[model samples]
Every structure is written in structure tokens, then in C-alpha cells.
Target: MIQLKHVLVLVFLCVFSGISQSTNGYELWMPYSNIEDSSLTKKYRDYSKSIYFPGSTETLMIAKNELHTGLRKMLGLASIPTNSNRLENTMIIGTKENLNSDIQQSLSKAYVEIGNEGFIIKTVSIKSKTVLVVTANTDIGILYGVYRLLNLMQQHKNLHNINAVDTPKIKLRMLNHWDNLDRTVERGYAGFSLWNWQKLPEFIDQRYIDYARANASVGINAVSLTNVNANALILTPMYLEKVEALARVFRPYGIKIYLTARFSAPIEIGNLETADPLDPKVQQWWVHKADEIYKLIPDFGGFLVKANSEGQPGPQNYGRNHVDGANMLAKALLPHKGNVIWRAFVYSEHDADDRAKQAYSEFVPYDGKFMENVLVQTKNGAIDFQPREPFHPMFGAMPKTPLMMEFQITQEYLGFSTHLVFLPKLFEEVLDADTFRKEENSTVAKVIDGSLHNQKLTGMAGVANIGTDLNWTGHPFAQANWYGFGRLAWDPYLSSETIADEWLRMTFSNDESFLEPMTRMLIKSRETVVNYMNPLGLHHIFDTGHHYGPGPWVSELSRPEWNPTYYHKADSQGIGFDRTPSGSNATEQYAKPLQELWNDPQTIPEEYLLWFHHLPWDYKLKNGATLWDGIALKYQQGVDEVAGMITTWSIMKPFVSKEQHEEVTMLLEIQLKEAKWWRDACLLYFQTFSKKDVPDGVSKPLYSLEYYKSLKFPFAPGIRPQWD
Candidate 1:
């Protein structure tokens, strides 16, 4: 029906407009794209035509700005006037204290259940007129509620009859940035750290503001800006000024900045003779340092300390235990109402009985010894962020102490940013793991949320994956892991399915065609990586140093725990680590039922067969295949799954942008290549031990095992710097 010149002009406009609005995944899950569904768009426009916000506080202002911005982008509406006529369909937002008396009274019942940072969003009738109200106890909660409303709109959810009451289960939902002073993040696959120390005090990067907004949207209240393997200079006046500048930027977004406290700061920066927890001079120095930090940033969240682990100096260096070190920092921070998150990830070459058993042994003994302001941070797995690991035994063991979970959002073990591994599935597996500490349903979620142990000061920390990359996280889908971590940290009970569904809708589209297949792919991704890289509970087999690729034969590390050979234990007889009573007795660490179940290879789940028992290659699995055949099949299955993902994505091109589709397609191809590399490299190397040919139906390796081993990646991103 259109003329030729009109068609040409339309094409020109569309092309130029698309160039201006092109997405490189920078918006993450908060992309407020204009709604294509006219019916839904009309409903949203009607609901948000006017606003009645009653506060002028910083957080309230942020919430107001966000509401205006999101609505303008999504509904194509200009800034809606605040405190406009509330006669019909007005969106009301404010803290309970600031709201009208009648509205505050109406929300009083719902307010009781939600704690300090909780919010209530409901469609209410006011004097015979319908209005949507977002009310909370504090300004920050109002901000959260506003973000929630935006999220719902982004996902194209119905605004009518909306009654949502939400609160964060964990008190301290935090991101532990392993970013160093030099802007090189440890185990960070993305580009350089978000913190630009060289230009900080004066030049405030807009990225910092956006970072705060992103974190605040997901209820992440705290951020430790430095690596746990800390540098003492961060505590000095020179860096404290920089950190203070950041804290000011994040404060309005309800994000409190934390610093990783170098345990030997008293000696390293203060020139003290000894960094002993018992020494008065060292204690005084820390107290003074705490005072100095609090003076600059009044609401500082406190310290995250990695002590006596991986060669980091600690109170252990001065004949003191974890309690001694943690209590000292806790005491120093107590005056400022700050908390200490002391890490429980410890292992020493000297205590080589079982590396997995060391953390529980070290911290469990000092259960009630830690100060009230201290929380012991433990990794999700006994080992370090393996693709698949049984929930750490320490979860149930430390009843008297608040054991905060430390999940790695960064894929340090599962192929970094390149691989599309959805970590929420892994996080869900650990959270839902039955600790059996009390009765049935005593989950790790319960342990960390303080319901199981009846302890206070609960928290969960995720090692941040963010960098200065244009997309924030290097890969587009890797942003899901960061989003998932924040969601889980808020409520550990949230299923991965729900998270994937939400993320896909917000980050991409609400179209069912895109959502269904993409959600399935994301949910299955972690298992795919596990199957290919560490089938049947085999773990820590990645190449030495960078851990970028397969290295099941590595045994050259000085520490036994650091060697891949120490974990797999592959030989002519079989492959696996025997951790039962007959071996290292690591099974004894778990609760009764798990101990009994894991002690026997026959009863243990086949996925963890290699972790708990050293089985023969010819051992029959539940699938009626030999262990060797099962391993090979799993590897092939993983590769096939990746292939399937590529196929799935190819068809999704119409649902997403050309750039997005192309980027993911490229990444999926890389995943397939790496999947094959893993399948071939590990199987080939293990074949030498089993002296077996490639199993039936499994693809043959293109190269020899020696050739796979000869490949090198000296400049792999995220390789731990030498100082660590």
C-alpha cells in the first residue's frame, strides 16, 4: 500500500534509529524496552498516568527518577507529575511514615511481616477510586518496591490486582569483589575492575552510579570493593579517601561499601612489630584504622577478611586462631556498628589429610567464640567452586555461628565468561541440599537464613563477575549469574526456573517462543558443563595455573590439593578419590544419613561416585553401562547439549536483536568447541590410565593426549596474580 519513496524513507529511519538504540547487553535485566503488545501497554499507561510520591529524601528521589525513566522508556510516557490528583489509577509511593494516615493504617498489617528492607505493592481503593500503592518502612524499601514495579512492567506482567509483599531473607546480601588496587580482578575473566582508583576521588565514572542502581534493584545492600586477598594500602588514608568517594555515590542507592581488611595491616601499614590479635598495640592500630574509615564513610559496611588461607597473613601468623582474628576485627568495628565477614576457606599443605575436611575442622571448633558482629563466610562447596559439589559439611556443623554462604558468581571453575553456564541452578542445588541437621526440610537455605540454627546476623556473599566490559559482564548470558546470585541471596528458596524465566523476560523478551526454549537451555547449562568437564563428580581437573582447559594429568604443583592428579587419582586400577571410612573418612563430616549414604559406593548417587569412592572402570552404573562408558557418554551428551543450544539459539534470532543473537551464537559455537576439547582431552588422558579405547558411540579425539597436554594458555584472563 506504501509508495516507493515512503518505503525508502521508512527503511532509512528504521536503520538509523536501530543504530542509535542498539543493545550490547549493557542494560542487563533492567532493559525497559517499549511494550509491543498494545493491550498491555495501554494497561501500564493507565496505571502509571500519575504518581503520588510523598517524600523528598535521596532514596525516594532515586525511586521517583527510576519510575519516570522506566515508564518513559517502556510505555513511551513523559515524566508523570508527583503528588498529582489521586482520584483514579494513581501510582502512590512512599515510606509508611511519610504516607497519608489512612494509607499507612491500611498497610500496617502487611508491614509487620516485612522487615526493615521489605516492601508492599498492592492495588488499593482510596475514597472509591483505585490506585497502585508501593509502601515500605524506609526510603530504601520504597526504592526496592519501585524497582520491583519496573521489573514487572519489563516482564509484561499484569498491573491490575497486584498485591506483592517481598523482603530479603538474608540481612547482608553482598557482592564480594575480588578486585585489587591495581584494577586487576583476581579470578576475574571479564575486563578490568569497575573501581578506577587512579581517577577516583575527583573523576566519578558513571559506571559506578549504574553499578549501584543495578545492585540496589536486586536488594544487594553491601559491596566489598576489594579482593579478599587484601592489600593493606586500602586501609591507609590515600585509598580510604577513594573508598569514601565511592561510598557517597552508593549511599543514596542504599548500598554500603565494605573493604577487605588485610589481617596484617597493623604490621604492613601501621609499622607495628607484631600483628597478634592478643597484642594491645595491634588492637589499638586496628581500632584507630576503623575509626579513620568510619570518620570518612559513616555507614561503612565493614570488613571481609581472608585470613591464613592461600598464604594470606592472619592471626595464625601470631599464634592465634580464626576466632582470635575475627573477634579482634569485630571488636574494632563494633563501635561503628560494622560487621566482620571472616572467610572459612582454609587449607594448608601441612594438614594434608584431606583438603575438603580442613575448613570444617578449623572453624567448627570455635562455634560460639566469634563476636556477635562476626559472620564466618564459607564457600558453597568443600572444594573451591567446583562445577558440581555436595553442599559443604560446615553448613550443618556450625550451629552456634552464623555461616554466610560464599558463592562464586564468576565462572572461575566452569569456563569463565565464555561458557554459558547458568550458576543459579548450581546455587539452587546447594541451597536445597538437605543438611539433616534437624528434622526433614532442614536445608542449607534454612542454615544461612537463621531459621535452622536460630542465629542472627545472617548473610550471603557472591564473588562479583562485573568488569569494565561494555556488557558489564564479558558474556551477555553471564549477567544472568549476577542477577541470579542477587535473587538467591535475597531469598534462597527461589527456584532456578523462576529466576531463568524472570531474567529471560526482562533481559530479552516476554515472547513465549523465546522464553520456553531459552529458559530450558539456561537451566540445563550448568549440568552440561559438569557432564563435559567433570563427569561423575570428577572435579578440579582443569589445567594448572589458569584452569582454562582440561588437565586431569597435572601433578606438578607443590601442594597436593592444588594438583589435579590428587583429586582424580586415575591409575591402571581405576579413577576417583576414596573419601569414605576406608579412605580419608571425609564422609564422617556430614550428618548421619548423608554419612551412611556417602560411605557406601552402592548407595551414593552416581553423579558423585568419583568423589566418594574409588570405583573400578568396569563398575556397573544404574544406567547399566560400565563407568568408563558412562563417563564417555556423559561427555558426548554434554557436547550434544551445547550443539542443541546452538540450534535452539539459531531459531531465536527473530525474538532478539541481530547483535544479541549473533553474539550468543558466536559464544555458543565457542562453548561447543570447548565442550569437545574437554571431552577429548580428559577422556584421552584418562584412557592412558584405564588403557581403554574410546567407548562405543563416543567421538574419537582428533589429537593425541600428549598433544592436548602440550597446548598452553599463559595469558588466560582471571589467572590469580602472583601476589595471591
Candidate 2:
């Protein structure tokens, strides 16, 4: 962390400049600006005067070029190729296959060994002069090594003893971009889609380059570029050329592109009568589609499908199972070494039963029937991304199927782009959840990553929050969510607080004046949002359609599971949804311990109290407060915490970019106002059922429950129409 005085100096620079600017945060974690530390800058300047990549391979060239771009911006020098005369004190980057005779001799001397996605950076005496070697096992490893070196420079780490070696713990670290072809994101809050398909094959956006750079920096190797609610047109020849263009740009960064496949593409694009998986014509159509995709981009990462769910077409329309649908695509892509990622977020309006049990019921019986290349990507929770939810029942139940964990970094169900909610905590809470697969350490993380279940080809995906905004994500602080998602995807065991601290130091300054309170605010931010909006496991209470504000009274939606009132069973005598045996029996979906744990309200954690049971409004909580009072206090506390975040940010005005700081300042104010809006609207609405007072010191609502209910947001972003 940085000292207080250094932080003050940054504040002075911003204040004296008198520049008040607004930035839509589109740059994301790749803010490759100049370095601040003089000593480290000098060290890098001395060490990287020139650089070399040993191979002529395309991936190696990309690694070398990216190093040039990042180092040039950081050191204010145009990087050049190494000259034999300048070989000493220069950075040498290569794979073992392409190293020079002398460098190869040194590498064999046991000073360095490379892992698959790993590299070794070592200082050595060459011809009685100092030289640094960044050697790896493969071209992909060399690219990753470049990113690690850039990160070390960003954090101002010492290069003298920089012998760091690492590889991704998870095999498939990926991002699932919910970007539509028309530039409208599904749950995206950053800006419009970055693809810009209308101009894509003609005009490649520079943002795509930076996007690849950012993803590579975090060890993300795969990207799916369309919304899961896929369009059949994306499979057309025109879009294939656009996708191939993106793949060309990202290939150098070691990222393979993937596209969401519409299940009925054979019917829509191939002019086939039916897309039945069992039909020979439909199967031949898929094989032809796969062949076409490989022709344009041989290294394409295959398809992500959301068939038979949320009205998307799937084989279920023909009375086929998920395994039939998924295996058909897997067989098509298998010849190209590609895999299919089939989403398990299935729900039916026809089945008006408990939403939490629907996915497990649909997926569990078909576990061992899936093809080896098929991955059943399940959301962290059974319901949509709620503020807090227990581990999805499918985590441990599908031992025979490879289950990929999917998390929402876009905050669709949280508060959109306005609230300051750090999502790493939410991620950690889910990863640490135990599935009781014959041992205590059988965490959901292990299950998803194939450690506990011993399945091969593990995968995890983050729903991307990227857009066309200048700052990447709209909220400046929200950049941390993107950063955290990458870090955790690489190694799921990392604590949320640890990721936050690292992001704070790299993105802001290393000063304690900035890090201390700021870290505290980030660590508690997720819980604060939960307290205000969906405390005690009360889920999906946001407004209908766009889901912008409080909507505990929303009960008139078309489907039973579409309304907030469906999740939170708040009535005259009690509050909370009863998912226990007495209610929906959702607890029976888990293992014995979890079943016991969630079935009994007393043993269950207060964080998930309402998620599992319904209790009287006057029932005494574990904290010696009644259920109604406890819920009310949490709401008020969330409001206060957001206010505190604003004050904390105000105090660290010196250590941030003037443009960035002012943007965050305004966002925090927006958060504060909305936090109060959530607290007031929720308390006023829930009170109608509980008939409880606002507790002694809590302020009364500024507006009536009727007025809050009258609120509407027709213009809010991310709400798809029934037909869109």
C-alpha cells in the first residue's frame, strides 16, 4: 500500500488541474498508462532496452508485439528488436523449441523449467554481461509470460529476483459475453456491445485488440461472443467472416473465439425442415455447419447453446433429452477438437412448481449420457443470479457429467450499473459451499473444476460486463468485478478480499490511505447490496421487466416464477419463502447434511434464513431482534454502508485519475441515492404485509408504498421483450 502523503499528492494534481470530466468506463483493466515508480521504471528501462522472441511462429509474434505495445506506453520508449551488440542487458523471450544454442544451454542447466501455461523469467550472466530470459514451454506460454511481465511492471515489482512461475489451476478459463449481434447486450450494463457486427468484417475496432490483451493478462483462454439467447443469423456466412476477423485478432493473445449456437440453426439457416438430433438430415446439417466454421477459423472454440430453455428451440421440441441435443453438437465439433457448452438454466412456464428444483430435475437423470466434449454449464444458483443463494443442487449431483460453473459479473439481478456491489465476495460464498460428496472439503469449486468428481475438461465462465463505454464497465469500481472474475476463474480458491486488494493497488495507487478504507468498502459491498435489496435470502425482489428498482409487490407477471412475490412469500402472518419439506421440499434436492442444514431454520445461517423457511414477523432472530426488525435494520445498514463508501472515496481524492475519480464520485452518489431508494421502497412495501413499525430510530419513507409501486422504468436497459 502507498503512504498517505503520496495519496495527497495525487489529489493535489487532480484538484489543481481543475479538470472535471466524465468517462464511460470502457477501457477496463487494460489502463496501460505510464508507470509512477521511478526506481522500478529505471529498472525496466535498463532491462528492456531491447527484446527478442526466438520463434517465427504467429503466437510468438503476437507475444513480442504485445510486449512492445505495453512497454512502449509504460516506459515512454518505442520498443525495438534486439541487436547482437545490444544482446546484453536485454529481455529474451522464447519457447524451449526456438531458443538459441547458448540460451538453450542455460535453460538445460536447471535455472528454469516451464509448465504448460507457465514461464520462467531469470537473470543470467551472458558473455560476462547481464541478460534476462523469459522462456516458456510453448507459444501460448510465451504469450502468458508476456502478460505476467506486464502485470509485474504495472504493480512496480522488483525485477532482480523475479523468478515467478505459474499456470491456471482450472483447465478452461473463459468469458461468456452476453453481447448481441445488434450491439445490444442482454444483461450488459457497460455500454453497447463491442462486436459492432454491422462494421465488424470491414472495420475492426481497436477495442477488440485491448479486449484480447485484458483477457490474456488474466489467463482467460476462450471467449463466447454472442448472447446465450442466440440468433440463427450469427451462423450465416456474413457473420462467420466477422467472427473469423475477431478470431484473427485474438489468436495472438492465445484466446480462441466461441459463438452461441441457435439450436434450430439447421432449420433456420440450412433450410432443413426439422432440427431433430436423431434425424439424419439434421445431423448432417450440423456436421456441415461445423465444417464451415472450421474453414473460416480452424481454432474456433465451438458453440455455447441455450436450447429448450426460456423459449429457445432445442431437441426437446421433438421429445428428445438434453444429452441428445448436446451430444449431437459435440459429435459435429469433435472432429475439429471443439466442445459444446450446453446451458443448464432451464425453466418451463408450463411447470408451475418450485423454480429451484426445476434444473436438477431436468439435468440429473441424464448425467452419464452426455458426450465427453459436452459441458453442462450450470449457474451458481438454481434461480437467476440473486444477491445470495445456496449452491446449486446440480453441483455434486452430476458426477458423471462435466459441470461448468457460470457466474454473472454483470450484476443483472443486483442493481445494474448504478450500485457499487463487489461480486468476488458473492463468488467466494458460492465456491466455498460444501456439497458433502463423502468428505468435508467437497466444495462446489472442486465439483465444478472436476477435482471432486474426477471428470476431465473442467470449465468456468463469467458473464462479461464489457461494453463500448470509455471506462469499460460503466461504474469505475465495477472494473474490479471483471478483474476479480478472471482471477477467481484462474484459481477458484483465492479469497475475494485478496483479489480486491490486488485490484485496488494496481488500478488505483498502492497507498494505505487509499487501500485501507477502500478495501473495507469493497469487501462489504456485496453484503450491503444484499441487505438492502434481498436480505435473509429473499430473492428476485427487483422490479418487473427491466428490474431497475424495488418490486416486492410485483405479482402479476405471466409466469408464476417471473414475479418477486413468487420468491418472497411475504403475507400477513409471516415472511420468507418456504423451500423446506413443509413447503416446496427444495432442501431434499441436496445431500443429507445440507438437507438437514437448510431444512431447520435454527441451524441455517441468517444470511439464508428466508431462502429456506417462512417464519412469523415477530419471531426472534439469532441477533435478539425480531424477524421484521432484523430485516428493517439490515436495509438501513446497507444504506449507511453505501453512504460510508462515498465518504471513504471522498477522502482518497488524491490517488485516483481526475477523470476516473470524478466518475466514481458521481457513481457513488448515485449508489447512495439508490441504496436509500431500495431501503425506503422495500420497507414501505413489506410493511404492508407485516404491519410492523419502522423500528424506533429508522426514518419513515419519504414516499408512500403506493407511490413507490407506481414507479416505472420503461426506458431501462437490458430487458428483452417476449419476442426479442
Question: Which candidate number has the best lDDT?
Answer: 1
Global lDDT of each model?
0.89, 0.84
**Lowest summed-lDDT stretch of 10 residues in model 2?**
15-24
lDDT of candidate 1 at residue 546, scale 0 to 100: 86
For all predicted structures, in order, the TM-scores are 0.97, 0.93
Runs of candidate 2 exceeding 4 Å displacement: 1-27, 49-52, 76-81, 85-87, 98-115, 123-131
Residues 1-724, model 1: lDDT tens digits:
7899998986665333422143788888887877767899888887776777877888888998999999988876766765544444377787777567788787788898887899999988888767889989888989999999999888888878889999999999999999988889988988999988999899999999999999999999999999988999998899999999999999999899999998888888888889999999888988998898899999999999999988899989988899999999999999999999999999987897889899988888899899999999999999999999999999989889999999999999998889999999999999999999898889999999999989879999999999999999999999999999999999999999999999998888788988999999999999999999999989899898888989988898788889999999998899999999899988899999999898887889888999988889999999898988999999999999999989999998767777888888898899999999999999988888888877778999888888998999978898886534
lDDT digits (tens) for residues 509-611 of candidate 2:
6667777888899999998899878888888898987888889888998788988898888899888889999999999989999888878888999898999
- Weakest ten-residue segment in model 1 by summed lDDT: 13-22
